[model samples]
Target chain A: MANVLIYANQQGGNLSSNAREALAFGSSLARSANGETAAVLIGPGAGTAAKEAIAFGAEKAYTIDSPLLAQYQVELYLDAISEAFEKSQSTILVLPFDRKGKDLIGRLATRSSASALTEVIDFKVEEGTVHYVRPIYGDKAYGEYTINRKKAVIGIRPKSHEPASRDENRTGDIIPLKIDLSEEVIVSTLAEKIESALSGVRLEDARIIVSGGRGLGGPEGFDELEALANVLGGAVGASRAACDAGWVPTSFQVGQTGAVVAPDLYIAVGISGASQHLSGITNAKTVVAINHDSEAPIFKRANLGVVADYMSVIPALTKALKKRMGVNTG
Target chain B: MHIVVCLKQVLDPELPPRYFKIDPETNRPDDGVADMVMDSYAENALETAIQLRDKIGGATVTALCLGDEDSEDVLRRALSFTADRAVRVWEDEWENLDGQAVGHILARTIQSFGGADLVLTGYQASDIEEGLVGPVLAEELGIPCVTLASELAVEGSILKATCEAENGYQVIDVPSPAVFTIVSSEKNVPRLPKVKDIRLSRSKPIEELEADDLEIDAERCQPAVALRKVYVPDREVACEFLVGEDGPELASGLAGKLMELKVL
Candidate 1:
């Protein structure tokens, strides 16, 4: 039977949602493969995360607790994870494709001498091989990859799979592992910065996104866009031009090189859709473009186009949305 | 600090699919478009390394890439970006090696190059997006690795970096002679080469190392992974449209049209 290992972590007694997603996905794969699922969690109070993973579907949870892991250090974490993989005899390693996930995949692939597939949207088992489909060329196309080796690893894309509901009756094994600190050497730590926004949903998870572009003119035009987004209960996004001009943080930019979003409703304000920008949100179920430029490229891909100035359309739209949905616009 | 940035030449995605064909057997394209250019994120990583070199004042940047013989074009482009030297790993069937195998081969090459204080790469390859080469190489070399790094600074053996995390951002402290797969950003965008630089790049040394030349396990040479197939995805957007006029004329009628389409 295949042994699937999940590399999970927690700090400050908190586990990331993506980690939960990884456990759920890995559990499903192991169940289907007639195998056992193991989770390797590092840090203090990571036991809470391990318990949560068990409740979801882990056959066993491996904890490597150490105060040194309170902050992420590459060497310490990798050494611990590599040991876990060796000990568990994990043939299939599943991890998230986020920052830590990406790093772990690389290190594990080398240490195990196994092939890796990153950004996998879904997977299927064929004979003894695991076939995975992933986006390539900045999500412009999809590729199907299969691993021929017995030991294989995959990085699951965020939100690609539905999360498993908590099952109180579900129970699994918990194993504790040792963490070695001698290998870890001090390099640099990210200066902790206060979070500016903690209440709103992340841009990737938002169901609706209202974005502004170059046509918004200056930074001031984004105020109206934000108002509309707030009314719609959506996050605000920006085109490359807007981000380049300092209209918004680079994190909010949607393009081939930026964030790839598939929101349910994408409203573009004063944005002329450049092909590069369209590459990011082309997956949106319904796209509405509001721009003064009648011949704008955004109009070509937009399901609905409004040829009006943002100053007039956005405020009116926001008010109408607020009245209809009773959403807090303040 | 000598930094080596490994690059690849890929079929530009914007180009129509008619110009390309994904080989069903190998899962990679077999079309004849080898205009070599560095991958976008690798370019960013190269830019970041160049900036670090400028600040530190004692580092040499080497551009190393593996592909068909035509990959020299990509090597030259990297050289034009002010890399001290360029090397193109030569292979007749280079496309057969998977990401992990590529990393193993690169690790051997890095050892031959005297092992740099730091190595940089793109977070994901545009063609495969496997993103294994950089990390696997670092592992094989027994060094630390950081991926998806947006900001980085190396002082002595310390690598202080900020990488893109799932919820927000993560600060990582890793020791160097490390490897980092850089995220795509315009922050440290690569600059276009001047005429003189381009001319000089043509004369830059291009070393060719064969995959067979590296002493690696024969099993690793074969890909542990295989590609089943590649197909065009189902088009989600309907091409059907409504005929309309400009501005006020359309604005008055827009709401009704949206309602008819059930888009309002």
Candidate 2:
């Protein structure tokens, strides 16, 4: 039987949603293979995370805890995960396709001589073989891949799968593994982590995103978008034009050359819908475009199209949202 | 200081969706469109190396690529941006190699070129978006690897970089002889080559390295994964346009729709 291993990623001492999704997917794979599903939690408080993983579908959880892992150093975490992976003896390994996971998946696959796939949107096991599906050409098409190797490492795209619900009544075995880690491998050390000034939700994780484009005129225009985003209890994004115009940081850019987001609701304000920009948000459930130009390309893709001056439209919309949500502006 | 930047030429990602077509037989995009350019993130990586070379005098930036003769266009473009050297590694059998095989080839190519103090690559290719080569190459070379680096600076043998994280940015310091996968940043915009420099780059010699020259293990260069099929995704949901007399009415109607959808 082919054992499946899922890396349970945690942040701020809590299990990440992506980790839960991986566990769910791993469990499905295990069921199909008639094997076992194991989870590996690496960091300071792995024991607590392991229990959480068990509730979320893991049959066994491996905890690799060490003081050196208090902060995320790539080398240390890589070594710990690698050792845990070996102990699990799994044929298939799953991880979140985020920043941290992306950094490690390729290296781990190379070291283990395993086939690897990233940003996997879906997967299926057919006749005891695993097939992975991923986006290509900036979401213009989809490619289905099959690994020929004995082992495979797959990185699941974040928010692509719904997380499995936690069951407190469920219980599983917790295994603690010990491996000798050398400090010499620690070539890179994180100097500091600067928090973003915008304090609601992360752009990638936000259920709703209010984005502004060049029609906002300048940097000051983002403030209005911010107000709308804040009122909606969501995140703010910007078009490439806005970022290039110095209206917002590149981090806020949502397009082909920027972050790909699939929020539940995406509100694009004063933005002409460019093909480059549309690639990032096509997966969004509902798109609302607010621009004065009636012939804007965004209207073709948006679920809601409003033709008006954003200067008057945005502030009024913000006020209406505040009223509907019953939030005090004061 | 010796720095190596890996480049890949891909179909223009900004092309309209209507123009994109995948060949079912080949499991690849149709090369009908002549809009091929260097991957955006790779351009950032190249710019990062150039900036570092400018900051620390005497640093040599070598641009390396693995593809057919068409890939030389990007290498020449790299040279036009003042890269000290351009090398292309190619073979007829290498056309369908997966990311792991390509990574091994790159590592071998770097080794043949006397190795480098630092290696840089894009976070991912715009076409494949696999994001495997850099980290796999780093492992093949037995070096530390960092991904999603937006800003990078080298001080002596120490490398300091600012990387984008989920919540914010994290400044990282690593030793020399490391690999970095650069993410696009506004500050690291690629410099366009002047017409004179573009003409001059044609005269510069580009070294061609073949698979036989590297003497790589044939087994190691075999693709680990096989592409089963490629197809355009079907758009299942038709866009529904909301109608309203004005801005406030439109906002209210959209909000109501969200509530109905139970996403609010």
Candidate 3:
């Protein structure tokens, strides 16, 4: 049986959601292949994290507790994880697909000379050979890839799979490893500066999104959408056209070249739904469109459509929502 | 400082895929193989890094890849374009691996190179468009990561980058020895590889590394996602016809039809 090692990144002594996803994925693969899954946590006060990882499905948990591991330092992490992987003789490596995961995978692949793959959406293991499926061509095509190595590392995209359930009764051993990292290779961290944090949740993670387009007029119009979004407990999104017009940030754009969102509720306000834009939000559970033009493409995709100017309807909706929710703007 | 930009050759997008192909008996244009070219976004990212190195001095740009030896042609082209050096971690088997696994091995190789102050990568590989490598590599390295970077400036030890965020441009100040994933921007447009530079690049170098040489878990790199099948989308648009008295009437009717379809 192959030994699988999953890096369980401890975020404030808890397992990151992405890490759980990796654990669930690795565990399922291990169970099917009769392999063993080991979770490795590297950071200060990661002992709890190591144990929690096991509770979530790992057979064993590895912990590397050091001052250098406290903050994310690229070189130090590479050194530590590489050392851990080397010592464990792990055959399969797993990590959450995120910033830290991305950095480690490429550099680790280079240093370790292992085969690697990224952003795979599905997988199957047959006779010990693993084949992966990923979308290509703007998700218009799906490609299958088979890896020909006994050992390899993969980063799992977040929210792609359900996380393994945590069993409180389950427990595992924490094996601490020694890896030395000096400050010479370290550079800096987020602690060095204070960022101007946003007041609301990030658009990528929000459950609901109310987006606007060119018809919204200007940045000032976003205030109404923002108000409506706040009333609906959702985030705000924008079409590429609106973003290009400098009325909104490109990050809020939902389209072929922008972020893909699959929210529970997606509201298109005055936006002519273009194919490129629809591709990003097609996965939303429920789409509602409000536009003056009855022929707007967005209305076709929307489950519910109100053929009216969004400016007139949004304020009323917000007021109704606030009144119903007993929320006082004052 | 030495930097490396890994590029992939991909199908061109300007000429969209032709979905329906008439049988040879009918002589209809088949979905011609999408013409292949260097990924535009990656090339732009490479240009940005190269320009940064040129402006700051004391930086070298190396192009790396883990693709078929034929792809060596692509790397050579990248060298001819802007990279100072080229290295192909040639492996015929890698053609099937996912981007995440590829990134894992690349990280290892980069780690072996040692002491790279900054690692620059494209926001996403055009072929897979996973947009995960730069972030995942950053996590693996435990370093600060700035992705979707539109503008970047390196001042002493700090890497100040302007990234496209949800609200407005976010100016991120990260300490050097960092990694950034570059997106396409006007500033990143690549100039043609000078004819003399192309000649010089041939003499530069192309080193090869075997996947087995890195010595990490051979199986850990297995893919998470598996593609079960690939079939072309059915060409099934029901064209709605609208008849009217005149141009405006016809336009309004078409608009009404669009409204009926809910696509304006």
TM-score of each: 0.85, 0.93, 0.68
What digit string (tens of lDDT, one per residue) describes model 2 on residues A266-322? 999988877667767867888988898877778877887778888867887787767
Best by lDDT: 2
When sorted by TM-score, best at the front, the candidate numbers are: 2, 1, 3
Native interface contact recovery, all models: 0.45, 0.75, 0.16
Q: What 10-residue stretch in candidate 2 chain A is worst by lDDT?
A: A321-330
Computed on C-alphas against the true complex, the DockQ of each candidate is 0.41, 0.65, 0.15
Task: Give candidate 3's chain B TM-score.
Answer: 0.82
**What is the lDDT of every predicted structure here?**
0.73, 0.85, 0.69
Model 1 lDDT tens row, A180-227: 665335443555432424247678778878899999999898888787
TM-score of 2: 0.93
The clash count for each model shown is 0, 0, 82
Order the candidates by DockQ, highest first — what do you get? 2, 1, 3
Residue A65 lDDT, candidate 1, scale 0-100: 82
Candidate 2 residue A53 Cα shift, in angstroms, is 1.2
List the lowest-lDDT window of 10 residues for candidate 1 chain A. Answer: A190-199
In candidate 3, what are the lDDT values of residues B1-264, reduced to their tens digit?
777676776655333434423234322223365556677667767787788888787789877776766667677778787677777775566645566666666677777667466777788765567665675566556566677776678888788877655344566778867778886555676688889978877777788888666655565465534444454433223323333444344433332332343211
Clashing pairs in 1: none
lDDT for each residue of candidate 1 in B20-121, tens digit (9 for 90 to 100): 555666556665663435676777888888788777877788888877777777788877778888887766765677788788788888888888888888
The C-alpha interface RMSD of every prediction is 3.9, 2.3, 8.1
